[model samples]
Target: MQHLLQIFILYLFILKIFGDNVDENFPQYPETKQLYETYDFIIVGGGSAGCALANRLSEIENWNVLLIEAGGEENKRLMDIPGLALQNQHTYFDWCYMSEPFEEAGLSLINQSICVPRGKVLGGTSVLNHMVYHRGAPADYDRWENVFGNPGWSFDNVETYFKKLEDVAIDSPSLPDYFGKNGPLHVECAEYRSKLYPAYMAAAHEAGIKSELLLGPNQIGVECAWKTTKNGYRFSSNRAYLVPIRRRNLHLKLNSQVTKILFKGNVAIGVEFVCANQTYTIYSKKEVILSAGAINSPQLLMLSGIGPKQHLAELKIPLLKDLPVGQNLMDHVAILGLQFEINESPNVVEDKDMQLKEFLYNQTGPLSSYPAETIVFSHLSNGIPQYEDDFVTSTYEQQNHELYHFSSETWAEAFLPNNQSKGAFYIYPVLFKPKSRGSILLRDNNPFSHPRIFLNYLTHPDDISYLVMGIREILRISEQPSLQAFGTTLYKNKLRACKQYEFNSDDYWICQIRHLSTSLFHQSGTCKMGPKDNLDAVVDAELRVHGIEGLRVIDASIMPEILAGHINGPVIMIAEKGADIIKQFWANRKVG
Candidate 1:
């Protein structure tokens, strides 16, 4: 009984210092005597970008900024623990969306669609995502400038903002120039050392893949994941940026479900929202910024009568501006659930109580490490297709398998599985820069309803061909000498949908991909940013909604194309840049 009591005391001490007690560090939101009638900025969706924008916009002293979130603060046990990353999905903190039935891909999934988990909490999806910190290849940003026709969005211009947001905790003395020294967001390579880490790196090297450091000029390589964790807990956008700066200038409204942006003529004037069964309208004096992320941002635009002409007309919505609000949806889809058996038992961080204790006491254990600890980025496309521009430009039907059957070199991101039990691990292969485009449409005109998300994944033949080649590459990696040294064996999950095909055959693997592939949740590009000439462009280079005044979207939805890696880092960078743009505009206006 004495031993048990001592253990309990130690556990409480650890949690107080590192776990539950960390909540006390945040400054409380100032009490408001009354709700202000207007504000300089009304930022919707207190998510990744919303939090950052709210913090930055409120820095202008008297500039009253209102940040409204549908979900509550990220104060749950599942959110703090790195091992329980996926446990947040489908919970109250998640919007728990489902994509519309895929016409070609995801043939075997439940309801023939994938679960689109958007963060409903204060931190947005930043609190929900696997904390792999990535900024994508330099060429990715160059494409944003050269290919997508957004001039200032080049890698050079955006690189500075990424550095501004990151406070790198990586100890690699040689990698200093590539990372920020004292930024607010804490980023470090996962600390928990595992046998699988070296083995995976060795396997990659043996497979002719070179190890490369990220955030530098070259980003493609197998390395310990750069994560947004510090002291074994998630350093979310809300925690890193909002909580510390909860000043009187910034007003945070929780559970405020925005139904529509209130627009008068062509300008966004205010927002109508519901909270606790009561409805209220909050007006924006200067601008209404939509940082509702990829899913909700476009959904709000459509609901506010800013979308395709015919689609809005069908819903009897009074069209404010006929823009492509929900087209050009792109996400990094992955073929996960690939398990491999090993000679030694995998690291057992799955134990909730033990992992919690370790995180509290030492801040260096399985709980301190990101689940997808190692990642490899490789190109599998044969060559650039002849109708590459046509593929990216064509309508969803015109850009189908008939136009492009993917050849030559394209990008694939490989991740080592997070599970640490049953003497096994899995390899998750994500199809980066997919040619396929999806759409988000209104289920009805109802503002409180969820949007019909149609992530037409693998609709393009190139998407499937690249994934097929990626699976072949994964198989080759599993057979490498380093993995073989650990008695590595592929754990083949027999799919009932693929029972017609023989196991391990190319056709069977293809069947498994269509049946079992899932989304990496890096959803983007619904509100694409392009020049005025571009018809599908919803927002301009400044993130302002086309043909609409005082409205701008500063979230993943404005990404012209998805990045080669995770979207969290890039999204934060976008918010930083967007805030600067808004500030610069306001400053110029004052001077004029």
Candidate 2:
């Protein structure tokens, strides 16, 4: 009895001597926060999905989670304000990466220069985007089942997951589909949209288009602005996911760049990084889930010698896995800043200071978020016909299947979209499913080096036609009487405006696009998801990388195609569901 008492006392003394009574809600990085010294799980890239997974996994209390993030936390004041999302673009929280300049573009973005602002902070890209909460069309995931061999990834399965992460505070009551109460993430609507919104919708209706409530019974029509904002603040994944479950059990590493994934045969053993000036190697007992975005995920895989053999040989890196690592990259490219001198300034941009002040005081302001007040999910006049299996790339064995499909056949398939566009009500469109595909390759073996991202935009002749058709649609909407009411003529007055409105030929539309094209900012499919038969797929339906064990890829990278709407919401749902899948698998294995 005395010995047992002595042992108990000794244990208590040791715990009091070393254990942290640290506040559970406070932030701690993996480099700094080590509760049990080693964790049960290690999640890489603490972005939208990564944080959510980490938070949920840490709920076990005794279980430890080590979350590795290249960026620091930005889910605070500046990032939480919807209006300030753009300001963080050039700040330290942003991984401000630019594309190799293209001569065709009017240097507005870069000489072919595409500036990609990745979140170098806790919430990842969610900290940078306009925070729109679009679940996309139900048919989106249905198509995943139809096109790929992914059986259970339909909307029915994913909707619950979406609800699990979100606690939506919809400002508009007429909006159907209430947000879940017990969810972690907060979603709200945009407070202030440019006055151009109404005219934009009216013009779409006038052009024979219809509106479809995004989360309602269907997704085949025009929509409304529903962003992930609460009141007037941005509701990032970190705010909803990581911050809530931050305790000693969960370690978050920031300002740490993962150098390599140390593997033993097929099992991923651990990861190494350059932190501050020192290098650190952290082992993962359970797994290393990669939540790096479309660009970086593939880049990391390739740097770890998991890409194509030819590409690896070129870079002189030994190939670890020959399966396609950086193939089938797809993104949406749109024309930006189509000018219609506002009849009256929507003033969202002009009154930035007052809006900021009001927000700072009470977190309420018009400019708090984009009043994507009305969203339209319409097919382009030049868009691929809504035939079944249009985006099915699973059976195709070719590397450029998507590119060839988009570049070749679209010329005769599309119409001259109505260009009589309205000037107000904030008009922005998302191409439902683009056929164009791209790839990522390492410039060198160095993990710190930026990889080469070739979007191969408009590589397909059909792609050019659709882009041209999109230009014509923009022209059509701009020509509407509602838009013209504000001296906002939609006729091509691009800096490289068509020489004559009457001579608006295909060449003119093409030239206008080449000059004014903007990235709709959806980069996807770099690390595609599907079965083993999917030649270009990097991970299976379970999101497990093809040739590795105890490793998973969850992020925008695993998307099979560019969804019809913003992919962020869907990506969050994926992470949420993935956490469950992983948890259940581990639980069952433990029982066994």
Best by TM-score: 1
lDDT of 2: 0.65
Task: Note the Cα lDDT for every prediction shown.
Answer: 0.77, 0.65
Off by over 4 Å in 2: 1-32, 35-37, 101-109, 171-181, 193-196, 348-352, 380-429, 479-481, 491-504
TM-score for all models, in order of appearance: 0.88, 0.82
Cα-based RMSD of the predictions, in order? 8.3, 12.8
lDDT tens digits by residue: candidate 1, 1-592: 2333433464466566666444333443443446788988999988889988998998899899899989887763446667556555666788989888866776655557778889998999988888888887777888889998998899899988988998987666676577777877888877786667778888888988788775566655566677888777788998878777658888888888998899888889999999889998999989999999888999899998999999999999989899999999998887754667776765646465776666655666776765576777777222111110000000111111111111111101112233434466667678887888999999999987889998888788888777777777777888999889878887655456667888778898778778666778899999999988899899999999998999999999999988877889899999999999999999999999
Name the regions of candidate 1 deviating beyond 4 angstroms.
1-33, 171-175, 348-353, 380-422
Clashes of each: 8, 47
lDDT tens readout by residue for model 2, 361-412: 5556554664445655555222222110000001111221121122112211
Kindly report which residue pairs in candidate 1 clash with one another.
381-408, 381-409, 381-410, 382-407, 382-408, 382-409, 383-408, 383-409
